[model samples]
Target: MPAVVVVGGQWGDEGKGRIVDLLARKARVVARYSAGNNAGHTIVNELGEFKLHLVPAGIFYPEKTCVIGNGVAIDPEVLLGEISQLASREIDTSKLAVSERAQVVMPWHRLIDRLDEERRGANAIGTTGKGIGPCFTDKVARRGIRIVDLMEPEDLLARMRSVVDYQNAVITGVYGEKPIDFDACFAQYQEYGQRLRPFVQDTQALITEALRSGEHVLLEGAQGSLLDLDHGTYEYVTSSVPSSTAGGATLGVGIGPTDVQRAIGVFKSYCTRVGNGPLPTELFGEIGDRLRDHGKEFGRGEYGTTTGRPRRIGW
Candidate 1:
């Protein structure tokens, strides 16, 4: 009858996935409320190991509905690959749904991300270059393509044409890089559109109706409070605020704050941070190495599930 939220108490890589997976047993729905492919949640059971980037941990339960809420930025390529990977293992993803209002990650977003990082040079913020920041930028700029637009070819093309021209100009005229081939992007996206159409829907309504029916829900969060764009480490934070509090949880899922019945914060014995950031207490050199080797954790060791980089350790 209420939704529960799982948030990271530290700088992420905190085991929120396993907690959500365990909680999904009682939840009728599990929804991912923010971020994009840049976030990863791994789950291990009798079905072997899985590193999920976009899909919710609840997908392991066939009876539970998994929703990617409106606050997320989706890379169709990554989502499709995950869907295929799950299918290969005889896992059913038919219960997964994407919000019609969710933003789409375009080819140019990745290209711009790399260029922007290069421009930062020595000051580079160590982004994953997965098109996350750029996609969200376009979303805020009102130039983003939504799931509803993606499933409709004619409208998608009309939008892509203008956005591509503008982005290519930024690449060539601003960054002095080659333009993204419009035709190739269109062709690939057209295929993606068809493949993803089945999962696109008015997810806000779906979530609302589920709540109305007195079903329990789980709102899964990505990143951590320390990586939140508005509140985390400046210039090195994620595009979204992944905290489970007020604006953090409900704003993304299109729900009211009162809908959340609990907020579960996941923490570890030590602090771990991925990407570039100021870790004042971080161990370096041999000391860092020894602690890292000691980390044969959760089928992923102590490395980041998203970046595969050895997580910086601190206590």
Candidate 2:
């Protein structure tokens, strides 16, 4: 059982990406078990720069295979768009495989996400407004569309129409917004389905086979342990699990409590967090601004990949 699990110990923005990228050199596989594009992993090496959202950080090394696990809620359009960018940079993403069980993030997820923020008003959770929370909500409700659903045209359309009708009612009647157009939305999803079909797979089997071969597999977790839904700051945590313990469970690796290995946590020289959450160690003086400025923390520079919002820097 040569498995290495990399997880965040702090409130996120930890250097988990760099650690996973470093470990990817020796590992046969690198898997992202949870979280969406909200978290951004910045890997800076001689091979230019890479900020991975949905894709695993190990993509830079062609030798390592990357898996996107079922626990993740995927946005196919965003993922394909990002993959194209990687291709433009000459990165070989052919080794990437996504789980058929992964949930699809529809356009309404984004709309509902923003509406939820607006509803929060002054009590906002500082969301990226990327539809992550809403996506998770749909997933838990058992009403979400999965990657495999993309394969069947009639089924996909039927599901899409039903969901759009349901969502449009909420948008118009409850949220006082315009109704969502099923035809347009269905067409867009159809294109996404066509493009994403090739990457969808049974990642569990692929990863299990690799583990059985005595190969080293590293589980890269997005977000931080402190931001976990169950353990993180109340009402301010991400929808997914971010701890090492959860990483194993989410990845389906079954890494036990006594796996008898090393546990490493990464943190920056400073502290920073994005969105509305309880930050016990946040700095509010010139030092905070200095750290933010020195880090070039503004705009979409190092913004949350999942949220697309600029992160708050601290020291």
Candidate 3:
């Protein structure tokens, strides 16, 4: 049983997607253990170029099982859109599975993320504004709505009403923004649930069974070690842990440490940090510009896969 985990060694954009995509050919199951649409994986193969947000990059392989683990916070709209986009490209997405225990990213979460970033102003953490941070916040605060909850209309409606009440208060009182419409939100998410229900399952059991059957499983992570909440630069890091050695992958996949046979850390020839953060080795001036241009690190190029913003490259 070969259970491998591929994690980013430096700040994200370390070609983990490409590595995972290549390695996925040997894997029976390839699962994304954490993060959400806030993290993007751009893959180019015989099928052309694709920028995957929520779904695992392994979906390209019709024979492999691709999973979104419970550690992820899923935005149903983004997920469905990605599925449709893949379908348009003639990729079979029927093998994709989502963890029912995963938390949901509501429309209000996106609003709150934007408002929060705006409030932070110059000191903003440079979030992707995809509601990832807020969704994790709700998860930690014990007020999150999971994929399973969405399957139950009445339960989901009741929980959404209470959550919206609290979220509206914060939006209005703290952020000074208008309250989200409960009815519209419920109806929209209700439909999302219907669309997503077919994909939901107990992913822990799924992966466990795969491991027990001596199948090769790959656990993929987003972001990077330097962006880990606990170990990275304070206030300028991602909210989740992106370290495979730190048990993030195991936790995401609901497995024990012994289950993982090895952890492969991916790094570029040089270092790069996306968004805002302390880049001790960041190159500036003409050299940086030349490097950026040579690497196509700006505008619809390599760096454009996720944010399009120029990556702060270094040694």
Candidate 4:
């Protein structure tokens, strides 16, 4: 197939990482369509176990091109950090490409995310506080900073000055928190932009050309269908569409619907959920505990890759 999309059929953590890792060896291009560092995948291979957040799982294959699509919210710090970590492990990240249109996760986004969750208290959405939601919010609001914006320091400064002012108001006035400093944040993110400049590009065009040449492309979705913003449980879902059929996978990568030749759904033997939400089929009491023990579902043992929280298990 020229294009294949791999999505989680259940709630998040449906073992899509392993599936993607296995398929990536044959794929010429492995592209991540949605979400951000809030989602993670753990891949175990001969190179070792790798917990990937911003980068794609296909990074294990040195020759395959890995892309982070425009549909994703990227934290430059996280992306660079992941690249650095991979480099430290002797993994070649030269083939990595980031979408110039991808929204950049600012430091204030993380702060507001944590504060928002804190304000919710008992009703918190169990977010990873990595600024995924806030970043997407800015994207939709048309006030977001993109990877391309980072290359223009003056424009970045101007945009940040305006956005940070409003963000500060909400942070201090509404949330009763300390305001984020514009200058300090600009300086910090400016460095991140410079570091990330090389990898930013028109990823949509790259994927389109790759597909035209009959290069096998795999689009990876993070989280799961149950966590998808539209199809998932209200108020508890992640901020993005996590289904292959949702068109987010292909659309985010700047490809047409017809470009994908196949869609693969990855699921586990049973259902599992992280954070908080409704799990009608959830197993509790003794059986649940036994299942948890057997499956090693507890955090520390086998916690969530992003939040490290013990997953709620179901039959």
| TM-score leader | 1
In candidate 4, how many clashes are counted? Answer: 0
**Candidate 4: where are CA atoms >4 Å away?**
241-246, 296-301
In Å, residue 249's CA in model 3 sits off its true spot by 0.3
Give stretches of model 1 more than 4 Å off. Answer: 241-246
TM-score of each: 0.97, 0.91, 0.96, 0.96
Per-residue lDDT over 34-125 for candidate 2, one digit per residue giving the tens place of the 0 to 100 score: 87876777778787777778898888889999888887778887799879989998899999988888888888888988998899899988
Arrange candidates, best TM-score first.
1, 3, 4, 2
lDDT of 4 by residue, 1-315 (tens): 469988898887888898998999899999999999998988888887788898999998889999999888898888898999999999999999999998988888899899999999999988999988888888878889888889889978888876888888888999888888777888988898899988989999999999888899999888888787788887798886334334678777888888988888888888888888899999888877676667752233447899877778887
lDDT of 1 at 275: 77
- Each model's Cα RMSD: 1.4, 2.7, 1.7, 1.8
Candidate 3: clashing pairs of residues: none
Clashing pairs in 1: none
**Quick one: ranking by lDDT, best first?**
1, 3, 4, 2
* Local distance difference test, each candidate: 0.86, 0.76, 0.86, 0.85
Over 6-97, each residue of candidate 3 has an lDDT whose tens digit, in order, gives 88888888888999999999999999988888888788888788888889989999999999999998999999999999998889999999
